[model samples]
Target: MAHLKAVQGSKAPATPPSRPLGLPGLAALALLLAGLGWLAGMVSLVQAALLLVGSGLGVVLYHAAFGFTSGWRRMIVERRGRGLRAQMLLLAVAVVLFFPPLASGTLFGHPVQGFVSPIGVSVVAGAFMFGLGMQLGGGCASGTLFTAGGGNARMVITLVFFIIGSVLATIHFDWWMSLPALAPVSLPETMGSANGIFLSLALFGVIALATLWLEKRRHGSVEASGGVLPSDRSRWLRGPWPLLLGALALALLNFATLALAGRPWGITSAFALWGAKGAAMIGFDPGSWAYWQDAGRAASLKEGIDHDVTSVMNIGIVLGAMVAASLAGRFAPNFRIPLRSVAAAVIGGLLLGYGARIAFGCNIGAYFSGIASGSLHGWVWMVFAFAGNMLGVRLRPFFFRAPYRPAVKGC
Candidate 1:
């Protein structure tokens, strides 16, 4: 719908008014949110607020980094500007946050806890596939959740199929594990987490410089856009610094989450847990479900808090996103779903669920948190999923329409 905007001098332009939600709808939303908060044991109003705000901040951080990535992809590749320098700046921030001990002898809490070190072939292959998948899916795992919460019907479809793909992958986990792997590529024996971080920084620097130089020399040889949407410039403030700082804050929040929970950042595990719970309620043995088929290897859903953590965290994410959408006046209801698209969503969700199990994390857990923790496998999953995303994008026309037009030009 049209929104009114005041301009200089002329008669105030009339615009279509937004349909405010009715009292009943608002009441229902409040009740539902209240029930969710209760179930999650957010006993105090303050705790509830903190959870909502923290998770919302996390989502915002995610989008900010995403925005920067999209812009850099355009500017550097288009030879329009020095996007590489911008990326380097962000990476520099990541380095300081991830490895402060190099200069000060202390990283995030428990310096020993964050040191997973690097590996070889597994990481390389996983990174390639992960990148491809994320591109095709139109978003990474966490991205799917945020978009779906924002009422993007197409994202809902993509999420369904992501679950399907992940679940299917779980069904074949033995085969995947049997695939070639590098056991212990510890950095301590070679260079250590701090040293490895520096090495990575150096390598990224070389690549960034080369990319920018090539783009400038080639005169806009690479395509200006990829699977990502253009930016919403108005959504961005006067400068990009706020968004950049927001990302660093997100990384710090993630560190806190890890410290508090004694675990790493993740989202898909929550999805799987919810799926399992739903299955059990419907008379199915969740233990027999493909997604939970690997539970025997970890902790059984019946025996551990995995399902609880998943359910609570997933709800928090949805609620957090909902709150943000509402405050930003971006909330709406448009749940029209074509049969074919429904099928795609279900299939995709199932796959995404299973694959996350097999890979041990989705985008955030495996790719972001994992990489930040120095896990070689984290990098592997990222590369492979990205590859999967790339392939998934090609199949987009068959599954759903892409609707991510943003406000920034040439981004």
Candidate 2:
């Protein structure tokens, strides 16, 4: 996670020099509570709860600096495997938490389901594009939201273009869906729940082991896996949390999402919805688009953004990060951006938006939630997306002067 700033081409310190309870943090906390109260009253208690979950995720993401883009970049460029290994550990834990409930077809008496998408040419191509885009945009979907929320001006630019790109993709969504595809495949259903869980853990173990081997070969030793344990309880609130703890927290939260929402955690669908709504405001008839013609999608469009679960969660993520950044005394926004970097943001955002739409999700929805749900497409997404990252890392030289390197060695 130390490499997060580096991957974003930022010059800011990885950790703020001071931790203070700022006025901005207090305001953010108050606003969060007010929003929760409003949602509970106007929307539903479930929506309010989801907003709270998203806020928690934002805190964890910002404080821990857990990011997929930087993790993959570090592995690809520096051969540092700590971030990649942390991801594998996260997946392993999630698989354990998810499989049993999914197999039973319910959690706490509510029907629950995983993000099982079809494996197809669209998924392959879209995931690769998304991976490449995240590298250029300097953040993945969740990374963009949290960083933008934390006051990274360049990422805000990336986020705007991401919305635009997602809207554009809907125009061509029908064409993409026409590509060769298979029915959704769930590993638990195919291989049995226990067997599927075992296979997933084994794969995660193999990947973690491979990263350890590669990192040791390159650096002559493996990097330590997590942050130093907090010296005091206060440090836990104002943190640089241990990476493994962040991983575990994410797994548990995602499981909570499944239990509460009846589906796993997701991110980019909200982007598309936002874009479509904007288009409608501008007198563009997005409702006619093939993507919006689906019964569920059409219903969402009619319901307005407040009624959309993903949109509310997405909003909470931004607000939550704002609070965390304020608490860390790191919520300074610098708008000065290089011409090339801005250009990269525009292009990268478009790619990320478009790719996520066609691919069914981004790192969170597809790769993380997907694999955790024991879906075959999730594994396929990982392969293509990593390939995209390889190409994206090479393209960085065009926009960035040099890859930012921190004083700290490991991610």
Candidate 3:
């Protein structure tokens, strides 16, 4: 042993900077999670891994579906090095657990849910609408939470408007739900959960190929946009593939969450849940909230949205995201809000909460999960929401135009 004085005089060993676990750690975690899943009868390790993979896929799809400038994209780009990778890994683990291989080609005792409906007028219309709203709103349903965490006051405002839009749509839910025009819809008899996963994966591949082709074709076009990829990548990682893989992993994780949890991917319901609770707290009868008594409906509206598990899971998402941000040293004080904007956020929250209730989903529910689950209604919601988003974007400037506005300064 070294002498006490010599030991004291020696410089303290340089401590390694604590960092988020990378891929290897993720693998170990997955192994542990596999045991937990087996004991719980939730999923096999393979299935859980698939779910994690599904979420990984979502991250990529999300980038493609919405332009890169969106809030979620910004968050991912900003935190490219740290918690971002961890998040992707977590999602991959989740996907494998949620959507495991079936026994004798079946998920559950019966066939997996869903039907084969080709791209119809409805899907086209819905996709178009969803794209538009997502663009204008500055974030989608899931986008709302992530962006909110990132301190984008714009997203905060957009979320409120989203709630308002959702509520407006909900008031007519009974009528919309009963629409005969939405008929001629067919849930696939052959496409159980596993089959659907295969189909989605195939489609994802096609989309990926098309995107690549488009990128190559557009290389010289103005649409290609100089400085499109993050600057750090140009200096360090130096390619889109890493980002692409990272994103795909996210999408796969989402799928996994659906499989193991027996629920679709989503985040908006938390806002709705909080909204409903808030209403009840303020003497508003939740029963009169249209979808308040619609637990079953909401549950089906999006996989896992209405479940207690989903609620807790979303809480996990928030905590997880915050932790990720903190780990990356990206956490910061939130932006300030003008009084009217504050009022708008409150109003937006109410609208977004109620609207999500009426619409049966938010961005994730209506758009992301909807597209993944093959729901026509999800598509429709996206379209109208786009219109709503555009309407919102235009109107936002009017409601809260003062420069350098301060945030309301509280959660």
Best by TM-score: 2
Cα lDDT tens digits, model 2, 1-411, are: 332342344455555556676776788788889989999999899999999999989888887788788889899998988888889988999999999988889999999999999999999999999999988888898888888887788888999999999999999999999999999999888888999999999999999999989999999998886554654576576666777777888898898889889999999999999999999999999999999999999999988787888888898889898898787777777777789888989999999999999999999999999999999999999999999989999998898787743211221
- Candidate 3, residues 160-279: lDDT per residue as tens digits? 565555444445555544433444232222355466455545544554454445444545321222232433432121112234343445456565555555556665655555554545
RMSD of each: 7.4, 2.4, 11.9
Q: Candidate 2 regions off by >4 Å? A: 1-19, 227-229, 404-411
Quote the lDDT for 152 in model 3: 51
Candidate 1 lDDT by residue in tens digits, 1-411:
111111111121222223344443354357446754674563444334434534554345323433222333344234533433443444445444554443333445443244342344434544444444443334556666655554455566776666555545544555656666666443323466578688757755785677667775778554332222224454332112234444455566665555444444567665555445455678876565444555543364674332354444555555544444443344454466555555555654554556665666766666566656556666566446645644554554675554322111111
lDDT of 2 at 24: 67
Tell me the TM-score of each prediction against the true structure. 0.67, 0.95, 0.55
**Ten residues in a row with the worst lDDT in model 2?**
402-411
Residue 92, model 2: lDDT of 95
